[model samples]
Target: MGNIPDHDSYIAAAPEAFRPVLNHLRDLLRGALPDAEEMVAYNMPGFRIRGKVVASYAAFSKQIGLYFLAPAISDHAGEIAETGLTASKTGVTFPPHKPVPDHLVKRLANASIKHVDD
Candidate 1:
């Protein structure tokens, strides 16, 4: 598919049931990375800092997925498990039926930022 132009447009195009989930996750990322630039990367809505991908989210049929562009994102397996979300090799998956926990999202965002800048 072609690019969605911007983050808002990308979120707007998601399934109705998924819009809020996407927005919520986006908000969490924004709250954690205020200085990060919003951008469309890999055809998904994402945040970038100093030219490096920081965080990103994608709306899917069964769940909303959040990716912290850090190799060690899975290092927080304990916290991620508490969110009741599935963890993949790349990121965490938040099922649509359950709201993603704000604290977990923030933690992932902070860790990602530190990994990028530290």
Candidate 2:
């Protein structure tokens, strides 16, 4: 796809390719950080609030990764297993070719926000 200037543009430009995942993620993030500001950071889609980086999203070659602002992978170890997330200290990667589970997104979004406060 073409180079999208911002998150909204990026998602809009690749609607057919990114609609389902992007929309789901967007809604979840909004729910988690109701007043967070949307912006493009690090050349990717991101959310922030009162100067804190709340979350970010990226569409890579083979997968999409949603990164939390803090490191809390171990906190949700059990749930992560059920969600089949490939995680790192700051985020979980969902293979692009696969579908993103709704429950997993909710759990992760909650955990991520909690991590921000912790």
Candidate 3:
């Protein structure tokens, strides 16, 4: 409630069923944004680049959620139609049941980096 849970602590504290998923998501974000710093923002595990909030991940009761702080899919609908990432006003969702697609994540990461620099 006061601050988002820390990612490492979250992974360490999560139930066994979610460990692998959390690990994969953590690795994906780290691999994508190798230089981003970890911070807790918006009550989620947030990543930043040059002080810009780029991405976030949350471990929820139903699924693990990832957010790319870039233009929403609604704004880039045509170009990224087949990516299968869903978006709302705030951010996108990558459901935990399926493996997070590498290409989609990379695209989102690029968008984040671009947006942060722009």
Candidate 4:
């Protein structure tokens, strides 16, 4: 992808296998953070609140990543582990066959929104 301007374009430019996953994640984020301003930053789709990015999502060759603040990941460590998804200090990554659950995504998004200023 080269300088994608928005989520629609970013998703369209992604690998065909990942488009649906990206779209699902986008809807989840929008619902979870209705007050957020949608934008593309760092060449990825993200949601911002009060000018601070609270959540973002990206698709790689083999997996999709949903990124939030570090504290949100840490806070949900146990839940993420139970889901058998891979997570770092700032994000969760899962193969297309094993997506992060929708409920979990919403929880993490809400947590990220809450901690936007941290």
- Return the top candidate by TM-score: 4
Task: State which candidate, 1 or 2, has the greater lDDT.
Answer: 1
Order the candidates by lDDT, highest first.
Answer: 4, 1, 2, 3
TM-score for candidate 3, residues paired by index: 0.77
Q: Residue 54 lDDT in model 2?
A: 71
**Clashes in each model (backbone N, CA, C under 3 Å)?**
0, 1, 0, 0
Error of 3 at 108 (Å): 0.4
Per-residue CA lDDT of model 2 for 5-36, tens digit only, reads 67778677543665668767887887877778
Residue pairs in collision within model 4 = none
lDDT of 4 at 25: 91
lDDT of 4 at 50: 96
Q: Per-residue lDDT for 1-118 in model 1, tens only?
A: 3678888998888888988888888888898999999999778989999998888888887788888865547668877776667888668877777866888788888888877855
Please identify model 1 stretches exceeding 4 Å from their true place: none
lDDT of 4 by residue, 1-115 (tens): 7899999999999999898889999999999999999999989999999999999999888899999988889999999999988999999999987888999999999888779
The estimated TM-scores of all candidates read 0.90, 0.78, 0.77, 0.97
lDDT of each: 0.82, 0.70, 0.70, 0.93
Tell me model 1's lDDT, rounded to 2 decimals: 0.82
**Model 2 root-mean-square deviation:** 2.6
Higher-scoring candidate on TM-score, 2 or 3: 2
